[model samples]
Target: MGFKPSNKSLLLEEILDALGQLTESLSWEIGTTNLDNQTEFRALELLWWLDTSNYWTTLYDTINIGTSYSQETIQHFFWDLTHLISRYLGLEISHYTAHPEKVAEVFWPILTNHSEPIEIRTSALNMLMMSQPTVSRFLTLYWFMQAEPSQQMYNFYYTTINSMANSKYPCYDKYRKIAAQIVRFVQHKWHHWSTGNYLLDYEEPMRGYGGIVQAILMANQRTGFPSVLRLTLVRQVV
Candidate 1:
């Protein structure tokens, strides 16, 4: 006996719901690292296969539909969902597709939207920067300069600059001067505090400062500067 259409649809829904639950569980269990067993790796491999086999069509469709949602809650949900997916995928969506420009088209609005949370904007910005580093270079630099000085923003800034520093592309050369200016601005603006030893003792703030120094040194090396010269420059700035 053949199954009815509604029965088949219900069965498919159950299967999808099960897959969603499995995905969520694996995400919480594995996170971005610490794969302790073969089972976890196999589960991740399966999910990766599914996402690639569909060429991220499900993700693209979800973003397209979610973008049209007028409710704030629904929009926020999509933002978080996309952010998680982006984190899990690691590589930019363009790497998995032929038409890479389309990746930028979808993410640009999210990155440019001021109302979006900084975290969401940064995620979108990272994806765009990875997909088209040269095209987005100026915008990324602009974002670093314009964004309010905070640990979160600084962390994102460090991530962007560090990636550019390590890249084989020459995009980091022209921006070296701008990067130096940004470092100086950040130091003068944010580190002009009177409290010295007390504030320096805080682990989080110190880590942030370390990140800034590391990023500056990397950027300096990209400019063909010697390590000693870079360290001296970092000392002067940081």
Candidate 2:
């Protein structure tokens, strides 16, 4: 048989070649636990420092003043990183849950905050909320209450769930459990989110926001292939 690549010697030239390949791999879609496991929290600490290093700075300088990576690249990176998280969830969720900050901060805020795309935001929130007990229910309710929700949004969410009902992934069950917890948790806080000083008119919340909860719950139990986790919302919650 021909020689295998990994079996090659680690001489000075060989070592450098290996590192070159490794660096190239990091930019591509690859699964890695070293950043989260072996290094523990220190890994991200260093990554943040690197994100600001001369490398990214040089890259930042190269881009046009108003240019940004295309939406496809951004989405690809998101999906790749998400798959890494899913692989580690069984091993790290409990630990990451206890120490939320253990997760890389650079990505956490983007995922938790509502400023980003709903799909991305929802995914991160789902993961983070899954570990936070009943607290997330009220939190989502709080944000939901404060925001000016739309009728179109309500239909969109309901439609998302109805669509998921036909899914085949086991993770869907896990999603449903999470959605149910949020709903039950928010039942007591629901009335507080409405306006007490409205003068003219107000829309019924059940007809608006209430439908979203139902749809989200249903979508959670909708299953899919292991590679494509049904964590569109969880990725947002990350």
Tell me how candidate 2 scores on lDDT: 0.34
Worst 10 residues of 2 by lDDT: 192-201
Candidate 2 regions exceeding 4 Å error are: 1-79, 86-92, 101-108, 111-115, 134-137, 144-238
The TM-score between candidate 2 and the true structure equals 0.31
Q: Each prediction's TM-score against the native?
A: 0.38, 0.31
| 37-144: candidate 1 lDDT, tens digit per residue | 232333233333333445455434433442333233223433434423444544344443444455455566766676655555555555554444443554555554
115-227: candidate 2 lDDT, tens digit per residue: 45444544444444444434444355335533524322233333333233333233344545544444442322222111111111123445442111112221111231111
Each model's Cα RMSD: 14.4, 16.2
Could you tell me which residue pairs clash in candidate 1? none
